[model samples]
Target: MPRRTILIVEDERSLAEVLAYNLESEGHEVHVARDGRDGLSKARALLPDLIVLDLMLPVMDGLAVCRELRSDARTKGVRVLMLTAKGEEVDELVGFHMGADDYVTKPFKMKPLVARVRSLLRRPDAEEAEADKVSGAGLEVDRERHTATAGGEDLNLTPTEFRLLWTLMRQPGRPFSRHELMDASRGGDANALERTIDVHVRSLRQKLGDRAETVETVRGVGYRFNENAVAAD
Candidate 1:
């Protein structure tokens, strides 16, 4: 319920106005960008809490924007809610390795989109509450400061990936089920799909580089941080 900053990137003038109006009415400071390139610029400059990005854009596509943002250390952690032209586009975005936090199909209702925004904003609160430094092996995760690094390189993690890594790093060796991880990373969004956890884990691992092997998959169970290397220190 706190005031949040949100950015809306849509080429549709009417849709952008409606989104800005509704989000502002909810006590959120909202900004709008008419195209993908503009959105990327505003996003880096403003660093909003969440972004509602449309897939099809004029200057650059949404996926490229997402990639560019995720590649930047400053804007990588920002939460993104992708707006796609079709339901199937969601799969492409998720599986395409753009590292988007969440997705919504076009022709969506206002109320549900608002709820999604609220939910996305809440994703990091649980981690923030338990903020503390956890380090081992060649990796480090700082909750209070909200940073993660491996092998002396900054990991440009999204909000969900950061939460997921923190959850595992804080509790090494304990294999967490997909459902449990989904709840941890998503703040218990019951509508969230468990399969999405795999997608996130895959993306997280990809960013992890060499440390990727530390996040071991337990057959018939789930994933766990290899305590032997990163128990506590």
Candidate 2:
């Protein structure tokens, strides 16, 4: 496997070193930043394959850093795995809305976190075999081209959002449970982080603009793309 680049933005000296060590052991080239401001700077320069962001960062804070990353075109698509001491669902949602691809609470085991990091680094092209192009509700995604556009305008989606949209649009009108979508987006075991799917969908819909209605939530079920549009030919 190619050595992927990763940036660790953590304030805790010991925690940061531990994360860096474990990731380095995985054969990844890892860089560490001690504060949010520094972290953002490294992220822009490195544009690393993935970022392990700490929620409670100094100088800027994780949400702000994530927001900045998502807004910057150069780093917009980079995957982010947020870590925080808070396990509250609301905190996770806040992080997700800021464009975190995955969330891990504090006191997390290094083994599982490493596994999740591996999953986050997996690109869409490396996922389960699927069609090259999918079009629906005026949105188009081309896996081979690594692009998602609405009316020819770039969606500028983070990696996670793109995967969720592709998973939904690939099979229009099929109700996918939150767990299924989670697995499809992150490429790992289905986790209880189903609610995070809602955050991604919300972000996706906002980017979809007027076409937001394309993704309909099924009560007690999950979400599905409206079959109203034709698949790309």
Candidate 3:
């Protein structure tokens, strides 16, 4: 795997050090920020391939930092992996809504955390291998440009949401299990909960607006793009 740059934005010195050490050992260029303000500053300056962000911080919180990153054209494409306290499902879901790619609960295992980072770093290459663009039912995804649109309006999707839509659009009418969607939406080392896929799907549908019907939930299975929706339109 090629070496990549990663930024760790955590207020806890010990935790940041541990993460930096592990990431560096994996041959990544690692940078550490002790607070959200500094983290956002460094992220904009460095434009790292991925950021390991803590949800709580002094100065600015992680949610605010994430929002800023997604809003700034210079930093919006940088991948974010949120770190939250254990069992904070609300924060995890909120992080996703704010455009996080993946997350690990606090007191996480080192090995799993390292795997998640590796997965995130490998995603771009995978996405680039796909066709440059795909469109149907007024929905369009441009892989080369990393952009999505619906009904002639641009859709601001997080990386995960974009990938999920891309996968479904590619195989319209084919039902995908949550496990399958989960894998397709994330990188090779993705370790997200199955329900996480549901959350992303909900958000994706909301963004689709009236065109939301194009993405059909498969009930007991998972989800599928409605091939007929495109034909009817």
lDDT (C-alpha) at residue 168 in model 1: 84
* 133-194 per-residue lDDT for model 3 (tens digits): 67888788876567898877899898789878877876678788887676556542335788
The TM-score obtained by model 1 is 0.53
lDDT sort, best first: 3, 2, 1
Better-scoring candidate (lDDT), 1 or 3: 3
Residue 66 accuracy (lDDT) in model 2: 95
Cα displacement (angstroms), candidate 2, residue 52, comes to 0.2
Each candidate's TM vs. the true structure? Answer: 0.53, 0.54, 0.54
**What's model 2's TM-score?**
0.54
List per-prediction Cα lDDT, in the order shown: 0.79, 0.80, 0.81
Candidate No. with top lDDT: 3
Clashes of 1: 0
Q: What residue runs in model 1 are displaced by over 4 Å at the alpha carbon?
A: 89-96, 125-233
Lowest lDDT 10-mer window, candidate 3?
182-191
Comparing 1 with 2 on TM-score, the higher-scoring candidate is: 2
Candidate 1 at residue 213, lDDT?
79
